[model samples]
Target: MKTLPAQLTPFVRSDVTGALLAETLGRPEEEFSLAELGRRIGAGGGVVHKEVGRLLESGVLVDRQSGRNRLVRANQGHPLYSLMRELIQATYGPVPVLRDLLGGLDGVERAYIYGSWAARRHGEPGEYPNDVDVLVVGDPPRRELADLAVRAGEQVGLDVNITRVGRDEWDAASPSPFIATVRSRPLVEVLTEASDG
Candidate 1:
């Protein structure tokens, strides 16, 4: 793994660390195995293992060996657990929160975060995004989506705007200039066929 510069002291640490913490702390009651964390975070097992070690040492996470598998979960008893959870959730919560929300809606075939936030996530150096822009492809109810966006925004501590479009309108062959422009830039997938439906 590449080392971060000595002067940098990000509260969330590496992307792998932030993502792993989000998954565990998002659902504090749920326990996850190391391999499962790696799979869920789309990171290498060794990378996940190293982050887990750091968390364990810091008392931010707790672990136990369940027969052959080692399981880890949030250490809710830690002094800084609540504070850290809030910070991590607000920063790294979009993907998991959006995925969980969109997963409940039957008509949401796909969902993505585009614009500035996506650009930054894609490694473009720039200012932090002021709002999160989401594009949903399918027929999910607009009113429900609006309400969901509000809830997601509250959790993320950033404004979340949703733009819903039918599957046809979102297709590459479609003539929508908006879709065309979005396709030309970075898009972070929030929901897709690969994840659980």
Candidate 2:
């Protein structure tokens, strides 16, 4: 999301645009209101509205008004639909992909993408991350977590590293250098137990 339109891939106009396509194009069957899109991406509603407007005008997305809400979904008939989906999956796929991969798991109190990938996603100017770093807080089975990491990495076409920490060790009160370093950087929340409920 931090990559400017020019710095971002040629297809995307902005961070919001990338996120919008990732949500709509990545899940073509689902429709999302502007507010929901903003919330999911941790972006402002105005930014999401603007991006949706651009996409609608360009026929990348189609929307219908439902009361006061604007419900939008991907336009499968658009000629570039396939290309857009592919680009979005590679660039903006982490959030939604990780969300899906972690949603059903038990003992996952919180999960996030950290390190350089997160820095880029959070708007910091940095080299494109060579791999994705994930921080999982809780005691999920290591085997299950590792398996899901492989699946996620395949979908995004990048190496995904999962680092596990117990809830108590991840706490700020604890004297863990790893937790402190992660806390000090840009982090993207993938999923949380509260988000599920």
Candidate 3:
């Protein structure tokens, strides 16, 4: 089977590591309590506790006690911080970032990433993808989504393309040629109503 990006190998080897990297490294400026981190990553409290201890010992993360809770954050001062940040962004940033950016928009039912980046993630050999192509299935306000896409593109260092479609159009038995093409391509689903459930 095709594997995750090589740079993410270490983190993906375990769910805990992957969640920690995705939740903490992706936002180095933010600190998370164990409970909050566990909730965000869908991990059990015990697993997060053990993994956080290991990470703290390895200097990949730093923690400080606040009253009864321990708050943890990525160790920005660590020598490998920058490289880890870049790899985290390359491997796990796009989907979550786009999900957060677009998931709350009114009428958005689902979102997917298609084209080059999706192919690359599926282990297709090629040059690195430089842009993110997002397909939004819903009737969200076009201007607002476009504006959010611009901001997200800047944050992720990629040109973001947002394509909107209505629910009826997306569920049609006979889709348009453009929709057919998208359906035939490799897709990385970022958000869906079912996912939340």
What TM-score do all the candidates reach, one by one?
0.88, 0.90, 0.72
Candidate 3: lDDT of 148?
A: 87
Who is ahead in lDDT, 2 or 3?
2
After superposing candidate 1 on the true structure, give the runs of residues whose Cα lies further than 4 Å from its correct spot.
1-9
State each candidate's clash count.
0, 1, 0
Per-model RMSD to reference: 2.8, 2.1, 4.2
lDDT per residue (tens digit) for residues 17-48 in model 1: 87788899898999999988887767888888
Lowest lDDT block of 10, candidate 1: 1-10
lDDT (10s digit) by residue, model 3, range 12-42: 5453566577679988899999998876655
Question: Please, what's the RMSD in Å of model 2?
Answer: 2.1
lDDT of each: 0.83, 0.84, 0.78
lDDT of 2 by residue, 1-197 (tens): 44376233554677777777888888998999888998787778777888789899999999999999989999999998988888788788888998888888888889999988877776777677888899999999999999999999999888999998998888758648778889989888898767766
Best-to-worst order by TM-score is 2, 1, 3
Winning candidate number (TM-score): 2
Looking at candidate 3, the ten consecutive residues that score lowest on lDDT are 1-10
| Residue 60, candidate 1: C-alpha displacement in angstroms | 1.3
